[model samples]
Target chain A: MADQLTDDQLADLFAGLRADTVAAVLPPGADAARHTVRRRRQARAAVTGGLAVAAVAGVVGVAVAGTPAAPPAEPTGPLPTADRSALRDLAESVLPPDARSAAAWSFSLGDETSNTAGELPAGSYRMVVACAGDGGTDVLVRWTPRGEDNLFDPERAVVVATGETACAAAPSPATLRFVTPRDGEVMVSVEAVDGAAGRAGFAYRIVPAR
Target chain B: MALTTDLHPPPETTRAVPDFDELYAAHYADLTVQLFAYFGDRQEAQDVVQEAFCRALARWSSVSRYDDPVAWVRRVAWNLAVSRWRRARTALGFLRRQRVAEPQVDGPSPERVALVRALATLPGVQRRAMVLHYLADLTVAEIAQREGVAEGTVKSWLHRGRAALAVQLRPTGTEVSRG
Candidate 1:
């Protein structure tokens, strides 16, 4: 019969278990790893830039648009519910031909509390924003269609831009003319004039300009 | 106001800052492996580690200056993994209740699967203590400090964890001998 296992034996057993962990997944080479790091850095910058844009725009919008733009009326449409993968596809579908995603976050709006000032009334929308700080040249912003309701109503589904500079082109419902300001960030605000219950929100990121 | 400083300014010692490239090269694989063992899922491990590294790179100038940069990354990665686990559990639980088939997660060795299954039987605290102790090879005091617990408590946990693991790992012949 075997005697009680010693601490050394126990440690050896644990070490053996570690050995059984199979081959460690090799990293995607040093160059790929470095690229990942850079991409991540840019994504962080984009998020920070988005926040900065929102802060600056909040101040500018009050000074420029006046009256907090009166939060859009909550929509009364039949909101669409989508899994994260569907939302991601929606975000990707609207990107400019050359744009690539860097990061993404999903959110729910029309709830009791407001997560962002740039929300639509009560329908689900995904905000896909990207940066051009690294080497790229434009930030892409897309909102998933809130579905049949007042989600796409021109007056209700309005997009507003506020910051150092206004949208380069005439502002459309979703155009902040991110291509206009070469350096500074701008907030791209969306709102549904009318709203209903159960709205979803998503944030998708794209690689910043190199 | 009187001048408070003399002519000498603080010395400029250029600390070696490992840029994103260097840092990723040095730590990514090891971190992924450690986290894989921590969570028993390779994809989740990789995702969380990548997210943590991204956060580190975002704050590189400051994060790189930490006493233990790897520890900073590991801590963030572990926290991210735990948060992901909580969210997935809730979401997947709902799916399970509705009879929906959840997505499959691949890439765990048979031994790893067994180990995780065995570890799951222990209390969460004991499981954490054992993994950090045996897998990470952290000393009792280090575990205590990391866990915000007393060293005596850590020792007790380690003792109990070892006893539980021994029973779980006992050879099949041992059961027959007792029988």
Candidate 2:
């Protein structure tokens, strides 16, 4: 009998089903509603943009991986070995005087295993650093500052073109600090060859002073 | 530099707009009910519908005059629900650990609840077609136009949706439950 019901009968059945009227919960005001809408729309836009950037990066990563390449050149200098403790120390030293350690970890170069230091609240500048030997090879530090709400910044120049370097000498060790001035929650990542990449980590808070 | 600039949300619109209060009064309850059926969660339904209305209010100057302003709200609300459904389910699982109270449920009959649950099990396309067809009173052609699908596809969805619903809603005994 249920299957035999005509379309009209089915429609009528649903239409006739009585439902309790939901109490009207009008928005605070039109202005407030407008702000809410604007914020949500902007958030959605950010997510969409972030996904697009991720896609581009993914494609670039694929293309780079596909091409045959020479092995990364060894740093022809009396540089310190890219060990964990040294990398951790170098990354930690760059923190602003007020910057408390939010989270920290070490990674071996070419491990391709990334670590998220931890989360930062909304509307914060996230400064990340990749510390390694002065191998002078390119290090890619990428991060997505994503909120608990999943909003993310995708367009940030996570890795400047391979040749565009941001390295600083740290005794025998060298560092690449990718200072991502951003808002909302974010995750950071660093990648390099087995010998060049060291540790990538970050610290952040809302209204982080410099 | 290009990436940093792109992160900034576009400038807000500044122009004459419609009377959002009046529009909200006209559409909020109905949109909420439609979405409640769509999501099988009244709180999520209301939240997404309210969000859609707020968005409509934001672009009232442009959206108010569309041939069907309500459709715009429904489309946005549905999209929001789909996106939220994935993330919210995961987040809610964690929130449940925190012992957050679930939203208050509107009273519904046992049969209706069963039916809605069955409806929820349908694929997204079929569910959307059925909701627009049965709840929203949208014609198959209208759904086709709105969803940017062929009319035949809409018809197929409605047919498949009905077939699945019939099995789910089929009677089990001599006692027939009235719709």
Candidate 3:
């Protein structure tokens, strides 16, 4: 009688015998998806981390301290339409000579649907731009220069802000060539919507881009 | 800018959340008791089976499409158990190397440990077939379909694996077969 049981019979007997035992074996179904924004952010940062850095072997005949790595610059505020055109100017000014008038870029800002256009010089690069804000209006810019197109400089300033008038002071039209010496800091003078001239200075400061 | 992606992804992913209740109702105890007999350690086997089942349920949308769910679950459960053994092999190597200038391991030798470890080293399918026969109480025809093999092939391997397991289970005999 013991060995004569068919597979279905055995399965049925197992179901009858161990229903509670099986339930006991199941995992304590905690919400694997539940986490605070802080935990979520922490998880993202852990991805691809702990990679042991290996020194590249090459002979440049002379070697100094290897290229210094810097933390990613924090994102700034949302770029308005005018800020966008200014960003194009910034990217253009920052990109090398061959890449100056000829580079492709992708821009996302405001609530409007957006995309990148124009043939970016060297034909190879990945760039993402957005309005950065703490749920407020702001502009965010991120880009990777690589292969032949890696000539884009990470240090360039295209606009100046003094008081509430941003991008108000443009250099001489003829002097507007791709390169110009950055003369002064973009003095950000934030005040209430209706405030007097040179009251207390802005509560916030925008550091001049390198 | 805050850019958030769903860590749990969409319905099309292997990472989709599980329907834990339904899976529990379906296969929990059968797999646990079965794995317990297979590994001869009920609590550890239960744990490994639970983890593997949770993993399976987490990835059910993808793994459910496999040809043999039982075989799949058993393989995952078995690997989780054997992983401890693979780790333990290094301990054996260290103990062996201690013979360079250390006290001898004296006793009526622990040949049983070597026998069990040797049984574990066989190809997973042969081992599973043997397990289903002895421990799970499944016939050759039952094992054929469960393991997704032809009936004739199942009988052939079961015959061979039985001989091997018998030798491992009993040290003094010249192996026996009954078909």
Give the candidate number with the greatest DockQ. 2
Candidate 3 lDDT, tens digit per residue, B96-146? Answer: 345323432431123423333444655666766755765456788878865
The chain A TM-scores for the candidates, taken one by one, are 0.25, 0.35, 0.21
lDDT of 2 by residue, B1-179 (tens): 11111111223245444466877767776677677667776667778887777756644444554556678778768766765665456657576334324433545655656666777899978987888887787899998987668999999999998877776666554344469
lDDT of 1 by residue, B81-155 (tens): 765565466566565334323333444445455556566677766877877788777799988877668999999
Off by over 4 Å in 2: A1-9, A16-18, A21-210, B1-18, B93-106, B172-179
State the lDDT at A60 in candidate 2.
22
Error of 1 at B145 (Å): 1.2
What clash pairs does model 2 have?
A123-A184, A145-A185, A145-A186, A146-A185, A146-A186
Cα-based TM-score, every candidate: 0.49, 0.47, 0.33
Determine the C-alpha RMSD for candidate 1 after optimal superposition of all C-alphas. 18.5
DockQ of each: 0.07, 0.09, 0.05
A21-112, model 3: which lDDT tens digit per residue? 34445443323312222232232223211111111111001111111122212224334556455533542333223223222332222222
**TM-score of candidate 3 against the unseen true structure:** 0.33
> What are the runs in model 3 whose C-alpha is more than 4 Å off?
A1-210, B1-19, B64-71, B92-126, B133-153, B161-179
Going through the candidates in order, the fraction of native interface contacts each one reproduces equals: 0.13, 0.17, 0.06
Weakest ten-residue segment in model 3 chain B by summed lDDT:
B1-10
Cα lDDT over the full model 1? 0.45
